[model samples]
Target: MVKTSMSHEDYLEAIVMLGGTTEVPVRSVDVANKLGVSKASVNKAISALKEQALVIQPHYGDITLTDEGYAYGSSVLGRHRMLFDFLTKAVGIPPEVAEEEACQMEHAISDASFEKWEAFVKGLDV
Candidate 1:
C-alpha cells in the first residue's frame, strides 16, 4: 500500500477550494466550516502548519498558505478534480457520491496515476 505523507493536505486543499482568496483573506472559521471540523482543531492544525512554515497567519482574521503549502494543496485539489470527474462522468456515479469518494481517493493516488487520469480527462476535453 502506498503511504500518504500529508493527510492534512486534504483539509488545506479543501480550504482553498471551498473558501479562499489570496487577494482577500481566509479565516480559520471558514476552514472549519468547510471541513466540518471544530474551530479548535483548525486552529491547532494551522499552528502546526505555521510551525512547519507551510502557512502564515499574520493577523487573527486571515489564514493563507505559504508557497510550499499552496503547492501541495494545489496538487491535492488537482487530483481531487480529476478523480471526481472520473467518478461522476466515466463511472456514471452521482455527483455527491463522486465528490465524497474523490475526497478519499485524491489523497491516495500516485503521481503516475494522477498524471494518467489528468491526461485522460484532458484528452476527453476536446
Candidate 2:
C-alpha cells in the first residue's frame, strides 16, 4: 500500500505500456511524452515513487516497478480492460473512444463496483 494512489499508479502504468516493446530503460522524457506531462514532473514523481520503494533506478537506469508497484499497476490495468469491454459491448462505444475513456475511468473505480461490473460483463452472452 502506497500512500499515493490513482494518479501515481496512472503514471507508472503509462510508463510500463510505453516501455512494452523495449526493456532497455524508461526515460522520464518517454513517460512525459506518453502521458503529456513534463519531464520534470515525471522525474519528481519517479523520485517520490522510488522513495516509497514502488520503483527502482540505478545510476543511469530506466524505471522498473517494484513488486508492489507492479501489483497495483496490474490491478489498474485490469480495471481498464473491464471498462473497455463494457463501453464497447454494452454501450456500443467506438473502440478508440472506449480505450480513451477507460484510461481515465480506471482510476476512480471502486473495488466493489468493479467486481460487480466484471460479473455483469462476464454474464453477458456477447
Highest TM-score: give the candidate number: 1
Across 51-82, the per-residue lDDT of candidate 1 in tens digits comes to 77767887565887766767777778878888
How much lDDT does each candidate structure score?
0.75, 0.77
- Give the TM-scores of the predictions, in the order they appear: 0.83, 0.82
Model 1 ranges off by over 4 Å: 1-6, 18-23, 59-61
Clashes of each: 0, 0
Can you write out model 2's per-residue Cα lDDT over 4-90, one digit (the tens) per residue?
666787776876676532233577778889889887888888888888887787754678778777766667777888899889989
Instruction: Report how far off residue 96 is in candidate 1 (Å).
Output: 1.2
TM-score of model 2 vs. true structure: 0.82
